[model samples]
Target: MPFKKYLLTGLMVWLPLAITIWVLLWLVGALDAVFGGLLSVINSVAPVAITVWSEKLRNIPGLGVVLVVSVMLVTGALVSNVAGRWWIRQWDRLFTNIPIVKSIYNSVKKVSDTLFSSNGNAFRTALLVQYPRAGSWTIAFQTGVPGGEVQNHLGADFVSVYVPTTPNPTSGFFLMLPRSDVIELQMSVDEALTYVISMGSVAPSLPAATLQKPKP
Candidate 1:
């Protein structure tokens, strides 16, 4: 019984840290793959004399990290100026004029906007929504709205949502649900995410106002 108690305590302590490390590892692996692909493209376009040196640099430890940082710095500058954006838009227009590149660039732009844009509406809220069936509710997030004439056709305040799976919240569904059906939680977005990712093991404590309220 004493041994079992110790094991349980140990798990309680290390479980969250273990999960966080796993998530960090997954992000690192994904970024490494993306940056490596970008480097490969750049290398293919480089001249013969520069190609050999670039290959050697690419193989070095932490070289990819340096290249990633350099790219980020350049991007930061680009978005900070009128000329830089003008040049970027010109390049985008050029790509859009091409047959094959147009499709790829457009798709990439759409995905980037969805994932990274603040105003894009993905992962905007943590709410309670009836899912799997009515009378049963689940935690989900607001993704966005149905644009154009779709709202007029549906005749409802509809917003996009993401219903995450247990253990790993990265995988989920993109749904469109009516605004009236969603129960907005008072807890913060980060707190809600923690609760969902922990499979209800961790939750945000009730506010003082709610906790102290007396029953009539």
Candidate 2:
């Protein structure tokens, strides 16, 4: 039991950082491949002229890292303007017209923008909910309220919560539970996630008394 607790605690310590580093490495690899391929295409078109500079610029070891960060910053700046916004719309229109690629690309882009954009609201609050069965609960994020016909069908009090699975939070279920039933945890989303994945082995320093709040 002690060893199990320690192992869970250790995973809580390392998993976030490990996953973050893995994602960062994956992005870097993708960028490197894209830029390298572009350089190869240029080299094929113009054999003598762009050989050395293109090779160096495209894959300058650590420079690629700097370039990736710089490009992200530049892209952030561009999307902040009116003309840039129009250009973005046009680009999106082109993508939307594309056959199968549109669905995949647009869904991913929407999620990324929601999660990463400063103006967008997503994962705004972490909640505790009875999951799978009564008495047994899990941590979930309150994404938003039930909308449209679902709201009409389900009633106004239902809310949408994203309940992520352990070990791999990438896949999860979205449940529309009654808003009154959801227990709002005081802990942040990151802390709640650690608690969930560790399966209570790494208990958060929260007390039952502290969780008691006067009904609003």
Q: Highest TM-score, which number?
A: 1
Count of residue pairs whose backbone atoms collide, per candidate: 0, 0
TM-score, predicted candidate 1 vs. hidden true structure = 0.79
In angstroms, give how far residue 48 of model 1 lies from its true place. 8.8
Model 2 ranges off by over 4 Å: 1-27, 207-216
Task: Indicate the TM-score of model 2.
Answer: 0.75
For candidate 2, the 10 contiguous residues with the lowest summed lDDT are 59-68
lDDT of 2 by residue, 105-140 (tens): 899997788788777557878898999788988889
Question: What lDDT tens digits, residue by residue, belong to model 1 across residues 68-179?
Answer: 7899999978877998889888988999999998999999998798979866667767889998799988899887787778878776688878899887788987778889
Q: Which candidate is the best by lDDT?
A: 2
Clashing pairs in 1: none
